[model samples]
Target chain A: MSETTEKTYKRSHEPVFWGLFGAGGMLTAFLTPVMILITGILIPLGIINSQNFSYEKIHGFATTWYGAVIVLVLVALPLWHTLHRIFHALHDIGINRGRDWQQVICYGFAFAASIFVFTLLLQMF
Target chain B: MTKRKPYKRELPTDWWLKHAFYTKYMIREGSSVLITLYSLILAWGVLRLSQGEAAFNGWLEALQSPFSIFIHLLALALALYHTITWFSLAPKAVDLWLKGKRLEDKVIVAGHYGAFAVVTVFCLLIITL
Candidate 1:
């Protein structure tokens, strides 16, 4: 091939974020409402016994391997999905300045929060 | 730098507010804000959980406040909206071919709802029972 015909393609980092976004979106869509109902409404309103959500029981659950993973996923994955949408929604709403900074802040918040939860879980374990 | 200034059409900030379709689209996208807040609450709970039982219980106690309850209610509504929008868009992502025929959109959408119901009930059961 002649040098004039040779072309280079740069890889985009979009698919990684998109994969996390898709997985998080699926989890959020299927589980978030019921989760909010149980933890936020039922338990708080005393419709469900507070003992069910007592510190001991919740602490025990968080200490376990599977429970830690569940807690991390429940707490963090939706963040990836939501932040992704918020990033795009910023553009849609016409906050068009600093696209790079927007992407960094959006995805960076999710990354930082995920790490925060992961570290907490690890310490508990 | 080459002086090639392309014309850029400006987008009005309230473009989505002008049409019902765009409004609903914006609402669907807007659900993310509340959901993100909900996740941060959960994350904060985890941080408290790591602190100690007393700290964790304090977090739970704080959640019982009127403001917390109201926020949760709003989050729940937005979350359910997100679920509906996500399921409606499911058919596009799940393109299944069986016996040389594409699956109907309603079938795929219904399947998601069915699974969503099962998962919801299952979580409630595990938490309560």
Candidate 2:
């Protein structure tokens, strides 16, 4: 193994860790509230006019500045966190043999996801 | 039963809060209580929807009450923390391989957060419009 092995001590690992944190927090700040509000609207709409409760028919008062920016933040962060956790786990459990190989896969998926999100976000704008 | 001896032992102030291991565990396991509470709220929402408008409005008004608002805020914090820890750990569960190459955990976590963010923004935009 070209890599060193020691599981017990904690390396700062902050680059990936904070990356995940920033992504997750920003995403959560944007995303969850709108979903919850939808549930709020749905509950009343369903009870009153069950047949007319489809989201497509309703105007989106749900759209807001807070939600959009928050989501952008989340989009960037969680992926980093996800990648970081995977790297350590591969090492700890002895699954993947080489560090370089692991790095390749992690970055590969990260790139693909980034491309997909960037495209999707542009459409939204 | 053994004897209890008293020595003036000073404990670390940071204690569980300072430790990553404990912090992760807290965010993981400690979140269930808040989840359960939120679920009950949702369930009530559903039940009221079935019951009709007046009942639903009553529930909504109650949610706006000071006490309910306080509890909701607390639950939101716990749920958010739990979500963070859970997504952070998602990459490891995959043993994720692409084209015979393994993916890094950070990338995976970032991807998941991105999806979450995008959806949140989209939904918000739809609502505000």
The numbered model that scores best in lDDT is 1
- A1-125, model 1: which lDDT tens digit per residue? 46877688999899999999999999999999999999899999999898988889999999999999999999999999999999999999999899999999999999999999999999987
What lDDT tens digits, residue by residue, belong to model 2 across residues B35-56? Answer: 3454446444434443455765
What C-alpha lDDT does candidate 1 achieve relative to the native structure? Answer: 0.94
lDDT of 1 at A94: 91
Q: Candidate 2 on A1-125: residue-level lDDT in tens?
A: 66587668777655755665455444444444444444434333343242243322221211234533443333434444445445554554456577878877765554555555444334443
Error of 2 at B48 (Å): 1.4
TM-score for chain B in model 1 = 0.91
In terms of lDDT, model 2 sits at 0.52
Quick one: best DockQ, which candidate?
A: 1
TM-score: which candidate is best? 1
Q: After superposing the true interface residues, what Cα RMSD does each candidate give? A: 0.7, 11.2
